[model samples]
Target: MSDTIQPPFSILFVDDDQMSRHHFARAVSDDYRVHLAQGADEAMVLLKELGPEIAVLVTDFRMPGRDGGHLLREVAQAYPQIVRILVTAYADKDMLLQTFNTGDLFRIIEKPLRMDSVREVLKQAVARYAERETRQQRLLAMDETLAFLAHELNTPLAAISLFARSVENDVAQEYDPQRQREIGAAATSMLNNAQYCLTLISSFWATVHKSGGQQPASGSGVREVRAARLLATLLDSYPFAGLQREWIDVDVHGDFVVHAMPNCVALVLSSLMSNALRALDGCPAPSLCIEVISEPEPEIRLRDNGPGIAPEVKARLLLDPVTTHAGQGGHGMGMIFCNRIMQSFGGGLRIESTLGEGTTVTMRFPGSRGRIRDADGEQASVTRTV
Candidate 1:
């Protein structure tokens, strides 16, 4: 519910049925600020007017004149940041999968729209939007800080080095004759190195800060990454100590593709690895499984045999990240950032854990392949043998 008394962000619900739209709004208005659009045409007008305020777009699959699929595709082209969700009673996997991949659907809700399920999905959607916004702000701040390092930091350093070099020369010369000669030579060498560094900084300032250009996001151009190849590279280069490498088992039913920045994928894997390793620290015979599946859209799953997370802790962490191991220097930002990254990829991360049993984290990527899973429970995997 955004942990706020007032509704946090706007959710646009588009449906041709008046009863359905009204019921959806009435049920969700307590948790979210709901906007009603009777069809794609009206939805477009509202989006144009209140686009910045809206965080999610939940439209029924069957709407008059332009339909939800058309609306979603148009929105994907224009307002890509808004999370897209589809509500459908259409049991056809082929149609759903096609719309899923094409329209960049963040999630699909089955018809008979249970209010409980709707609320939960809306909460997650809101969280995803918030996390994306937070990440953008951080990126902007990081860019500015980098620019400061390149442009604003050099002048003071130049002055300091100039004066310091002169002072060092004078001190070495005036102090004692023999030692002073040795010291002066050393000081001169240091100054030469400092001058070289300054030259490099000046070059960087000129090249990067010209006209105050903004730096694009890291891996902004990345998409359609091969899961098998990427996993191979990550496992090869990932730092594993002693038997840690052997402890991991990769079950490749078949290679599949994922769409996201390569760096983001690496970052997600690294975080899961770190967390799993920490959880296994005091355990006996630890193991982790990396499952690469081709069906129901390409997916990479990581299952770890470690102390499973408590439900309460998991709940709190999902809502607001706080380190479980703060004493051990954990900042607790890994999973939420991973969640945001997965959302940014047009998929979502699902975590299932039992107290005594190990945890399974599934990373779902958006694509049309094999049989589609149920929107709620685990999907039947139709594996392609390599």
Candidate 2:
């Protein structure tokens, strides 16, 4: 079996002077993948193309057109993961101070650069990059594990709540002995499932915490959930009432099944749907369409005819918690939470929007392998049985 390996750390050296760029690249070529850019414009292009792979950026401060500080600021906003270093021949104290204050500049190299000093700075930059990456990966893994745990615990709790309600209803009314027995059996099953899930969660945390905080394997408590039924449950219980509820539409392409913990999928959909509803608050003739496509992949597309996201908001939408509707109590963590859940499922979430037009949020899940009956007694499509 082939093992997955990370590519070598890369550095992008940007300088208007050809000799400086060439010398820098040559010095680090042996230890890193060195990329050369002549100016800030070229550096921007390279940054776009190799943002994720390039770990460090070294740019000359006194370049024509946009300066190194400009490039560093851009990288800080768009690709904060990239470590930035500034090189300058003339050491202007005020300029250096401003650069440090405004940009994510890691270090500054003085004029007539010493090869040894350059090498040391490059080594430190690589070390810092690796440290940040490791910390981020650990946090992300922990976030995923926690989301899975919450979903696992929530699903069984929901089942218990549902079964408890059934028992309450049966006892409240004049019930047949057969109906009472059936309700009792369902309650027993719910208790058993809850107990099993609680045990699994306990063991999951113990293993994860003991194993140096590594991510726990997925599908530990995964169960098949029907797409159509899931959507129906969400829509029926949606906070919207009366005519407002009529604005939402759900289209399921045949019977589709998603092999995941039911609550995890529901949590993702709920977050997306809630955002859509909020976006449509003041729109004229607002409508939300949810389409579930089974073949090719199990994907859900939630499209809304509402005011699209602003450019500034769209740029950092999933990167951090940001809210466009701060006045209306928007926490801005909904999409981030949803993104984490999808990633934990080995899936992804995508959002596309045109200002003044609308926004479409696509959620792709692991494809189904076979067929299974949903809670509504309807068959759903899947690729295989887990």
Candidate 3:
């Protein structure tokens, strides 16, 4: 049952007959919150006031002003969430057909209704209401999740744009060894960031399409990803400008490899890099270091020499949206999204920081070091470690 429908669910009984209305309310008052309305006008007033609370509507077919069919149709249009049923003493076949065709009628009870039959019909109506409410809530939740995902991708998209412009600028510069190297690095980084954005977009749309009753093509799942190479790619491609680019170091100690999706890994690293850069805004000797540990568990440690997280903020960092730099336009969904991604890969995210010191974000991939395979069923190795 949906939380919207509390115990002793509400029902609006609308009829012109005072005797019939009172009789029905008295019988069902023990099991439901019965709201008696003399006619369609009174029923409309009650519905306008307590529309969301009322789960079922039982109206007489032949009322004085507006007939039951008209009232049911009005209810269907105004408050479609409510389950509608018509009651009539004159069971005219033509009238019943017209009523069924026009209104959102759930069930029709004849005049002199049996208590047992009414109870069963009400049970079904409540069940139907619950199902519809649950579906509506799920749809609302999905919309919110999609909105959050779009918010999460904004930083990366902006970074990609900046990196692309940098690549163009670096390429147009005078030909020199240093300039050439910088151009090459910038181009590579631009490509990696673009690919990361595409991957996130694809994953998001795939979920949306699946929810909309569309079947997505099956593809390879998690695979052996070289941690050292992945981190290097991320570091090179990250959109860091001016002195910010110089304030970063990469240290790879061992052959770190983990079975995971490359794009997911890229997104997690990108998010961490963005956070580190943002935190290092106004520091004197702002430096960020990424360390890879392969022995105990494949993990990447991102350490930044900047203002650390506050105690209250650190406690619910990944669980909720909390940002120390919200004044600089932070939505606070980056780390939370990263944490969720890590959890999807059978991994976890950990954060440690002191007030005056800095923050260290550890992305732990706890699994055995796996060998990557090529298309020809051959084991491939990444020999580069920085």
- Where is model 2 more than 4 Å wrong at Cα? 1-7, 173-181, 200-386
Q: Over the stretch 54-158, how does candidate 2's per-residue lDDT look in tens digits? A: 999988899899998898898899999889998888768999999998996899988788989988998899889988876675566456646645654554566
lDDT of 1 at 58: 98
Using TM-score, give the best candidate's number: 3
Q: Give the Cα lDDT of each candidate.
A: 0.70, 0.73, 0.73
Global fold similarity of model 2 (TM-score):
0.52
The runs of at least 3 residues in candidate 1 whose Cα sits more than 4 Å from the true structure, single-residue gaps closed, are 1-224, 369-386
Candidate 1 per-residue C-alpha lDDT over 29-72 given as tens digits, one digit per residue, 9 for 90 to 100 = 87778899999999999999999889999999887688888899
In candidate 3 the C-alpha lDDT for residue 166 amounts to 71
Model 3 compared with the native: what TM-score? Answer: 0.58
Candidate 1 global CA lDDT score: 0.70
Worst 10 residues of 1 by lDDT: 147-156
**Sort order, TM-score high to low:** 3, 2, 1
